[model samples]
Target: MALLLTFGSYSALDGGSRPLEGNALDGAVHEAGFDHARVGEAWWVLLPVVRNRSGADVEVLDVRVLDLPAGLRAERYAAFDAEETGAPFLMVRDGGPEFPSGRYADRSGRPVRLEPGEVSRVYPAVKVRVTGEVLGEPSACRFTYARGADRFTQVLPCGFTLRLAA
Candidate 1:
């Protein structure tokens, strides 16, 4: 079983709630039971899923976690694997999307184009580490992607929560 956290659905703050045209892409982060995560742990599981929710196809350049809480590191994986005896799991990696100048045009990786009504495969799991900070309260994960001429970020409420150790 899995517990998913959704902080809330929101467009890029700069856009000021402009209607998403072309069924803009919105997403959620899937995690294991929230209680299993504790403050001070170095890592937490994150499964990112992006959906094309508009009437037209949406081009997804890259999907990565942005605006991660301070002292937390963002790591991304390309796929998840299952073993014969172990539970289904993802091979976690270090680092998230790094672009020069924070400009949308500087993006270089292969872009993924999702047709309307399509969802991305959850693989190469994404995990965040609490490098430093007092994070007993739930932190936040802002999932951002580039589509067409726009970059949209949606933070699902309670979608990724960090708990204090008992």
Candidate 2:
């Protein structure tokens, strides 16, 4: 089956001036750009950016990968940008020997506030690499974000097919 994208919304924070929950959006994942370059014998590079123009704070708690030629599944846990660190709460697996599973705080992470007639960037990442056999195989990336107690998921089909170097 073709990958699917779901959007939703949430209410404002309990003790803050911003909204904590997000509502389902009404569109698909807007593709910015993507590239896969063979860096090593079996290593591939990937970079993708997705955005949510939803009127509220969108929370992505988990991500599910599907619809690829091969059977590969990946789940990610994420939280809203921390009030102190200003980073999107994220949980990732498959870290190499150097760094295993741990929390990541983005240096550019910032609280996004929208006005009555304004738009802001929801999610932003320009460089990300996926290793193993998935580097060059046709695959799909489905992501989820979360708020106080609410969550939203969005799936984006890759523009270019993934493959290994010949």
Candidate 3:
């Protein structure tokens, strides 16, 4: 199957700043955007990739999964990859591979700095475990970053609707 262009809504949290873009967004990284098969039956690896369209370097400080569906639980956010550097390191939704240095670790503080026109190959392994029947749900994600010492938080619409194959 091919990837699907899915739309989702987002909101600010923890006093996060609003995004420069619109509320509705598509998962440009993964195929079909969100997941594949059921959660329990499979673990969907979310390789969240985004480019810095801005004319400045975006220092992504932290990323957090704001809300999730009932039956689906966020398991682990592990490892990241950068196209500039072919390597893997321990990473999470909040913690990603360190830029300029290309060092990967299991911590939630280091920021993923993306330069203008630069792409972040963030392979954040999200274990989507399905337990029960679930309806279409929205998964909000907050990305906090800095631009020349100016810190701003933008929320993205990473929601998805899960259903079994007929």
Candidate 4:
């Protein structure tokens, strides 16, 4: 039992983030295209999957976008199990089947827990409603999680630049 406890503690302490292969979007700036005429239209800006490589479980506390540009507002954020639902950008829509049902209740004051070797996709969607041309530097998607009693934050450079299309 002592050995088992030590192993569990070691696994929990070894927790961190890993980039998904073929979808390594870190440091890549994606352009969020929005209609200039159509203001107040919301769109989902999805981030790449975050994988937990530890041997123990980790609880994701919060997810947010850092350094958002003017006119681009983050209305809400969510995390979904990548294995069950696939890509959130493709599966999630305003009136789609997965919009209101398939998402994990991470934002409902409950942290999403990920088992060892699990991958989850984070979405911090932006609401576009600007009169002038909106262009800004790349922003980052940050994820805060806890392993056992220790807290850690992983900042993924899933940058985004706003572009208004005619």
Query: What's each prediction's TM-score?
Result: 0.47, 0.38, 0.56, 0.59
lDDT of each: 0.41, 0.35, 0.46, 0.46
Candidate 3 clashes between residue pairs 3 or more apart in a chain or in different chains? 3-32, 4-32, 39-130, 40-130, 63-94, 79-91
Task: Estimate, for each residue in 17-125, the C-alpha lDDT of model 4 and write its tens digit.
Answer: 5321121112233454333323444545555345556677766565567777765666656544444445445322333354553344333245656566655443333
- Give a tens-digit lDDT track for model 1, residues 60-147: 4333444455655664323322232133332222222321122222122435555666664432234565555535433343444444
User: Could you give candidate 2's per-residue lDDT for residues 25-119 as a string of tens digits?
Assistant: 33233333223333332211121233444544443333333443332222322222234325321211234432233434432323333322222
RMSD of each: 9.8, 9.9, 9.5, 8.8
Query: In angstroms, what RMSD does candidate 1 have relative to the true structure?
Result: 9.8
Off-target runs (Cα >4 Å) in candidate 4 are 1-37, 80-86, 90-108, 121-132
Backbone clashes in candidate 3 total 6
TM-score for model 4? 0.59
Deviation from native of the Cα of residue 74 in model 4, angstroms? 1.5
TM-score of model 2 (CA atoms): 0.38
Tell me the spans in candidate 1 whose CA falls farther than 4 Å from its real position.
1-23, 29-44, 62-71, 75-108, 122-125, 130-134, 137-140, 161-166
Model 1 residue 145 CA deviation (Å) reads 3.4
C-alpha displacement of 89 in model 4, angstroms? 0.9
